[model samples]
Target: MTTYYTEDHEWILVEGDQATIGISAYAAEQLGDVVFVEVPDVGTAFGQGEDMAVVESVKAASDVYAPVSGEVVEANQELEAAPETVNEDPEGKGWFVKFTLKDPAELTRLMDATAYKAFCDNQ
Candidate 1:
């Protein structure tokens, strides 16, 4: 499966009906050493582009959005213990949550890695 990224700096990789979500590496770099992550409770629902969590860094607080409408199935409780993982590895160990996708077609609204890189460049 491929990953899709948003203008809000969120990234998602959809595999089957589930998607793993997180802030982009660029966003983590800008946030400057993540300190805490305020996340939604598992089983809560959010719409596409909805604000589901807030990631706080030494520099600022950034919102984490739902790449597609879905119910949050799992969260990274590890982040509450060590949010710095976000800054250390935005794509891997840093992933914030997993959700059951609402509409798989909404995945088309996002940019692929190549497009995400261009979007970052334009910003």
Candidate 2:
């Protein structure tokens, strides 16, 4: 699997044409104690950079954007019951959605782990 990061602090873990989407640990930390998450339903399609989900925390409510165009295949329902999972494991079990990539080429526009770290460092 190849992982890509967006400037907005989202991450996409791509394995073949399937991708898992989530906020980075940096984003979870910034959000401060996630309380709720609204994930797109399966079959919902999103264009690159469009709002695909919403995350709310003690500090604020934030939109989680689609890093690339895709159709949602799964939404993490565990989040509805234990939203704090986002704080505990932002990139693992905390993932918001799974998608079937619409265009693999769109991934070329995202940052790799190294670039994303540097991008966060400057923020």
Q: Which number leads on lDDT?
A: 2
Per-model TM-score on C-alpha atoms: 0.96, 0.98
Cα lDDT listed for each candidate: 0.90, 0.97
lDDT of 2 by residue, 31-58 (tens): 9999999999999999999999999987
Candidate 2 residue-wise lDDT at 108? 98
Each prediction's number of clashing residue pairs: 0, 0
For model 1, state the Cα shift of residue 35 in Å. Answer: 0.9
Return the TM-score for candidate 1, rounded to 2 decimals: 0.96
Residue pair clashes in candidate 2: none
lDDT of 1 at 106: 93
Tell how far residue 80 is off in model 2, in angstroms: 0.4
